[model samples]
Target chain A: MQLSDSLNQLIEALRCQPGIGPKSAQRIAFHLLERDRKGGTQLGSALTKAMTAIGHCQTCRTFCEQPQCDICLSTKRQDSGTLCVVESPTDVLAIEQTGQYLGLYFVLMGHLSPIDGIGPKEIGLDVLEQKLSQGGINEVILATNPSVEGETTAYYIAQLCHKNNVGASRIAHGIPVGGELDLVDGRTLMHAFSGRRVVTQE
Target chain B: MQLSDSLNQLIEALRCQPGIGPKSAQRIAFHLLERDRKGGTQLGSALTKAMTAIGHCQTCRTFCEQPQCDICLSTKRQDSGTLCVVESPTDVLAIEQTGQYLGLYFVLMGHLSPIDGIGPKEIGLDVLEQKLSQGGINEVILATNPSVEGETTAYYIAQLCHKNNVGASRIAHGIPVGGELDLVDGRTLMHAFSGRRVVTQE
Candidate 1:
């Protein structure tokens, strides 16, 4: 059927996401048309506002509206000489939901994937090393995902932390094989967090 | 986790759609950030644009950008005799996808569900009767869904059409039980279209 050019354009734009196929895109488009016209407007405004307002935290590289994220700004947090490293800002959110791990975060913003041409520098590993060298960090937890790429990235970071003589640990691999951190259940994620293992220097 | 107020607001607004949970909403929000920052803005803008630009088709009761929808405005469509009656505009799109029907459409926009307090006036049955009495149309294919509510609505409309001496027919029920037309495969929808039965005058 011939939808209006404007409606068609909107659906085409939404189809860029991973799971949203054409049919689902059309359903979403029609649904937006059916209800929440005002909501649709807000979504547009919010997207622009967020893109322009939110920036990566200088310390952790996680998304933040201010120069420092809430976790970084708060003195109430543990900050007990421990830091957890992760791939993306969303990962930080996943970890925070447990209400455990009060230590600081170091967001990599990406993982090491040689095949994809992503190197240590691409993921801000040098920045991480610089932060560790500054001292006061007794423990560094490798909380990257459990994928092959994540494992490789974790190992590289772990080796670097050991060279700097900082205590290094790797988050557990209890997560299912070939699973994304975002897809894991909350309780399972909690278990994985508590079962982290210390990395032996080689 | 402490999401910024704007990000949190965007997530809340997106969660209103069917099948979108909190995590999915966040994923979509993040993906929007990564790609099509502009398109995300457009989606919100379009939501408001469509909501404000469109209203129900005056003739069919289906959503339309103008007073008469594209389907109604098309001179190439077979508008001389037959009319296909449907429950919603989405249903109209479903039927149109088959490339089988060449007749005009009359959208009910709702069904006769007394428990939901929906009645004839609410669904625009009076307008349908008025169109039938105008005496140019010969057949009305009742393309309402096969659910209990859909069946009841079809029967009520069929009765009205028969009393007015207009030829009325109900679309087939070969559609699987508990299945919506939008979800059914196009081929099966084609089968249902071909297998339509004529409504007997009682």
Candidate 2:
């Protein structure tokens, strides 16, 4: 039997999510209608509000409802004079959860990919250059992922930082803390060995 | 760092979907904001419209925007005098996809589970009884799931149909087509043996 138009529309629309497929979309639609109408209504309003209202921060390009993000507006982070560059807003969240970094973030929103036509401007590198040239930031921490595209993007940003006479350092690439040495990939092992630090220089 | 209020709320509201966790919610939120704002907006409006407008069909108790679902209103299905009772709307979709079972459906929405406080009335059995007593249905197919609760519910509904002088039959349960006997679960194998049909009469 044909589903109602509204239900069918909702199911079709749900395919916009990253991993959901047709079956999953239908399941989710039925779940909301059968069990969680209140949650569905709340999600609808939330999606509407976020989609229309949320935009990139003027300074950092991370998602925000206002002109600037919270971290960018904070005086403490500003005083630190260190900028952490990353590929996405979720990376900002991951770093923030660590509570180790006290600096503003410049979210690239995506990595540089020449094949897909994504470049400096597409990932907002022009904005990053402007931020670097403005001269408040003493250092830039490239925290992009370890993927090839992420590396290319980080290297490009590092070049920009150097051109502006700012110190740029990449986040370490090594085996995870709890990961077994044998399980680590060749590249990671090589990087770990090459970048090893002397704990006790006796 | 604290996400913007709208962004955070969107993430939280997204967790209402089955199988979505906090991390997936955040990922989906960022994905929508970054890549598919138009799709997200469409989904939001569709969700809002569906959640508010769709209601249980008065005839079959299935989800629809009208008093009667399309299948129930169809003259062909109505004339069949066969009503298939199921546990959810998705089951109706599944049955319909097969191009078989061209009959009306009564969605129970759930099965009887007294431990969880779900009773016959909760699954819309009263409405089903009313439909049965109205004197047009010749047979009621118990297509509820084969679980214990489903069996109990089917038995209850079958008794109701008997009282209303309507025929009741349970859907067959056995090994799936193309399923190997060795791989089939013991219960299913037992069912296959017990419910064996005489294909040819010597």
Candidate 3:
């Protein structure tokens, strides 16, 4: 039997979520309508508000309601001299969750995908370059993934940092912790070996 | 770095989707805000509209924009004396997709989960009893599953049918199509064997 027009439309609309298929969309739609009406409104209001209120942080390019993100504005964090450059705001969150990196961040939002017409300008490289050129930043830690596009983007950003007289470093690539050697990919092992650190005598 | 207030709120609100955890919620929140703004708005508006407009079908208890669901109102479907009773709205959709059962449906929404304080009245068995007494349904197809709670609920409804002088039939329980016998559960196999039908000479 055909569902009501609104329900069908809602089900169709829910497919907008990443990884959501027809079955998942229908399930989510029904779950929202039948079980959590209040939560549905909260999600709706949040989406509506985020669409209008959320934008790029002026200094870091991360998503935030204000012009600058919380990381960029916080004086309690480590000195802004060391900046971590990443592919997306999610990457920033991942690093922050470690509780290790207390410095600031620069989110590129996307890599330099030339095939898709996504160039340096598309990811606001000019703005990042301008910030680097102003010259207080001492080092740039390129924390992009080990993919080809990530390497290229990191290299490009590194060149920009060099021209601005700022030190640049790429994050080490290696097999994940708790990963077995046999299960590790060959390329990752190669990277881990090449980037291995030397032990110092006591 | 802590996400902005709106972003955090959105991530929190997105956990309303069934099976979505903190990680999936964060991914979905970022996916909507960063990449699919228009689609996010569509989902949001759809969710909002559905929360207000969608309600229980007076006849079948399935969700619908109108007082009666489309299945309950359709003129093309068979107006036979048969009525199919399912455990949930998803079940109704599942059965409807088969395009086989031409009869009307009555959704119980849940089984008799006594531990959860769900009794016959909680799942609207009283209303179903009232409908049965009005006297148009000649046969009730108890399509509820063969699980403990489902069996109990079906038995209760079946008794209601007998009181109203209506025929009650349970959907056959057997190994699923394309299922191997070795993988089939013991109880299901036993039911399949006990309920086996005799072959007629063609």
Better of 1 and 2 by lDDT: 2
Which has the greatest DockQ? 2
Ranking by TM-score: 2, 3, 1
lDDT of 2 by residue, B1-202 (tens): 8888999899999999998998889889999999999999999999999999999999899998988999989999999999999999999989999998898999999999999999989998998899988888999999999999999999999999999999999999998998888999999889889999989977
The number of the candidate with the highest TM-score is: 2
| Candidate 1 ranges with C-alpha deviation above 4 Å | A35-42, A76-79, A174-202, B34-39, B76-79, B175-202
- lDDT (0-100) at residue A17 of candidate 3? 88
Ten-residue region with minimum lDDT total, candidate 2 chain B: B18-27
lDDT score at residue B67, model 2, on the 0-100 scale: 88
Q: lDDT per residue, candidate 3, B1-202, as tens digits?
A: 7678888988999899998999999999899878999998888788788788888988889887788877777775436778899987888888978988888899988889989999988888888899899987889999897889899988999999999999999999989999999999999999899999999999
Give the better candidate number (1 or 2) by DockQ: 2
Best by lDDT: 2
TM-score of 3: 0.94
lDDT per residue (tens digit) for residues A17-76 in model 3: 888899998888888776788999889888888888899988889998888877888785
Ranking by DockQ: 2, 3, 1
Q: List, in order, the clash count of every candidate structure.
A: 2, 0, 0
Candidate 1 lDDT over residue span B35-70, tens digit each: 456767666666556656767778877776678877
Task: Evaluate fnat for each of the predicted models and list the values in order.
Answer: 0.45, 0.93, 0.83
